[model samples]
Target: MTDIGYIHHEEHMRSSDLISDIVIGMSDGLTVPFALAAGLSGAVASSSLVVTAGIAEIVAGSIAMGLGGYLAGRTEADHYESERRREIAEVESVPEREKAEVREVFAGMGISPALQTAIADELAKDKVKWVDFMMKYELGLDEPDPNRATKSALTIGLSYVFGGLIPLSPYLLVSHPHEALLYSCIVTLICLFVFGYFKSQVTGQPPVSGAFKVMFIGALAASAAFGVARLFG
Candidate 1:
């Protein structure tokens, strides 16, 4: 007799909060600063000016993105807490109504009425479990981690800084803005394509198309910025 063994390893990567934060930060970081440098390159003669402006923008953008991430995390936690409190209050004041809701949850799950009542009655005896059940099943909420806000802020901010540096690095080494812009365009577009490729693989999208799409967006934004700056300058 031959037996087959099954393994449960997942093939695709799942995105976490960190991944979400990095995407938010890196996407804006790479695109915005690339466009800014392209615009400045068209308008300015000195690479020094472009480098300075890019650094300042990266710093400000990182802070703003970090703050936004922090606020979003805090809001999520607060909303979950608010819902939990309401659930707790209902469990105490109108328990029958709450239990009926539990029955409804089971009914939706194809549980028979008699079995649903028995299960609801059994589940209600433990207030903590009852409240937890409602919070998850009825309200669709999970408790937020205490450090989620801080972690999100740091992750997004750091990612923005890292991404912003890639486009700006050429300016630091070169004296002419136009020359630096050429190098920046080459490197940043490559980075964008690579980033998108990996991101697509993780999220289960078509990698080659995703890479081209990302590269196109960054190129378009930079081209538009450079064109506008050249026209205005």
Candidate 2:
């Protein structure tokens, strides 16, 4: 079929980029700040200290997490570029070897030797297409979006700030640390459960189980921190 005659199906699907950012940012954001607040509440009588410490942690965590995400994105792009260059060199310097490699891929896929040779020959004629094909099928690498690093950094940082606010919001209203913590626990646990449910739905897992699991983890972290702080205090 002609290119114009073919229907593009990609428009129907959604990108998982934003979801990934939210997951990374929110998971750490919720868990870390919640634990810190819980720990502080156990040790301090005033909610203001907890609020101050929580804000500091959220700011630091967001920056660190965002930087890490940005670095990861850059590393992936660099790795892909390096592999692309290597593939191009290999294709130029060792044409037969590259063709054989291409044939091997199709052969493993159950394509006949004749068809493999034909496809390899056609692929070899176009250097860019050949490298792209090798990059995907042979190396299992995709061409990342150019703005992925910046977008991922911003998404993760902002999501962290948003998630971190949930547990800390109670402290802003309540005067006592213990009272704030009680409310924070309720709010954070509910948010974690709901977040996990929707996350599981997106990832094709059981929503009920995921919700419980996430809630348990959040509770566990906060409880552990609170227990330790109380022990020392």
Candidate 3:
């Protein structure tokens, strides 16, 4: 097992939808509860209050975020199904019109009229395939994954719980609100930077810049919340 300098392997692909769900969930999970904790810290003297409130917010936030993801997934599925049905109906009811539309598609791509007619005619022979092609190229839609709704719900909910725990962890260890806030800020800010760096890597942005950007936004939100709380308290 000593000959592994450079190996060739097939490239693996990952799902963009899952990545999007994680980004949506984790970003909010990290920021919102963090800001809330910072604000609560400024207002109260007891760490217990901050911890209790933070846990409550985390539970509520996870459920709300998960439900939102599930709804979005279901809506996407519904829209795809509706369009699919309409496409099927149109194809069945108007073969000639659909054939002409197919030719138009090829024609727009700079194919010669004769070639366009030939291709379109061949495509029109198979109603199912033609409908599928039209759905993809003309309507710009892909079939939705059947498991998308349930998967998105779980992913977003779990990610929120994980992210919310970072800032809330410090309050569990300390007795005073300010002391807990100090530790929470340190831990959460580091996690945010790391999270943003990896997120940028996946999204094809500059890692350092993205990290700073995320960190700054979180800091700004927390600072604003803390200031408001202190002023009102």
Candidate 4:
């Protein structure tokens, strides 16, 4: 493969990590608001209440998701930087020890000592490549772009709000609670299935399985909320 092709392949694989964030946002947006609307429908029996609850859920949840994501991204960046600096220092101060460590890392992976030594020697000849390898293999970390994390958070938060709107739209547009709920359920399930299929594509899993998993979690969350509302209301 060409260099660009390999890079693209790697990027595609890395994109799977964002799926977790997307799923979290989507679940939060759809489940919480739908449950709130459902609960309000049960307690107040008003379409207005359902719509209001959904609006509140979307606004509050979006802000929370965005702020949470930003803070988390910042924290990860700081930690990565700190660890990278430490690795760099070790490489500078203890070249021999670092070389042995690298050799041992390879040896533990079933490579012969001689080959490991040669590989480490060649790798260590380039400081940037050596550091990059150590960070990835030894520390189990990849350098993340700061902008990417921020964008991820924003996308996730928006996705959540978007997903949530699916269940609430019927209530906003229709006056009948039962019909609204039914329509909401249908829309929510379709969205869940689509999201799951996309997630499966990213992770190389079965689309049906992922769809079911998403639906199951959304159902559980909404059900739990409904139960809580019943008990308290």
TM-score of 3: 0.92
TM-score of each: 0.96, 0.93, 0.92, 0.82
- Ordered by TM-score, highest first, the candidates read 1, 2, 3, 4
Report the lDDT tens digits of candidate 3 across residue range 45-72: 9999998999999999999999999999
lDDT of 2 by residue, 1-233 (tens): 46987777753224398898998999888999999999999999999999999999999999999999899889989999999999999999999999999999999999999999999999999999999999999999999988899999999999999999999999999999999999999999999999999888777789899999988999999999999999999
Those runs of model 2 whose alpha carbons end farther than 4 Å from true positions after fitting are: 1-15
Please tell me which model should have the higher TM-score, number 1 or number 4: 1
lDDT of 4 by residue, 1-233 (tens): 45764533344444554777786788688777877776665566678778887888799898899778877888888889999999999999998888988998998899998999999999999988888888988899998777766876787789788878889999988897767877887888788778877777777788889988988877777677667777887
- Which runs in model 4 stand beyond 4 Å of their true positions? 1-15, 227-232
> Which is the leading candidate under lDDT?
1
Best candidate, TM-score = 1
Separate clash counts for every candidate: 0, 0, 0, 0
Off by over 4 Å in 3: 1-15
Clash pairs for candidate 4:
none
Residue 222, model 2: lDDT of 99
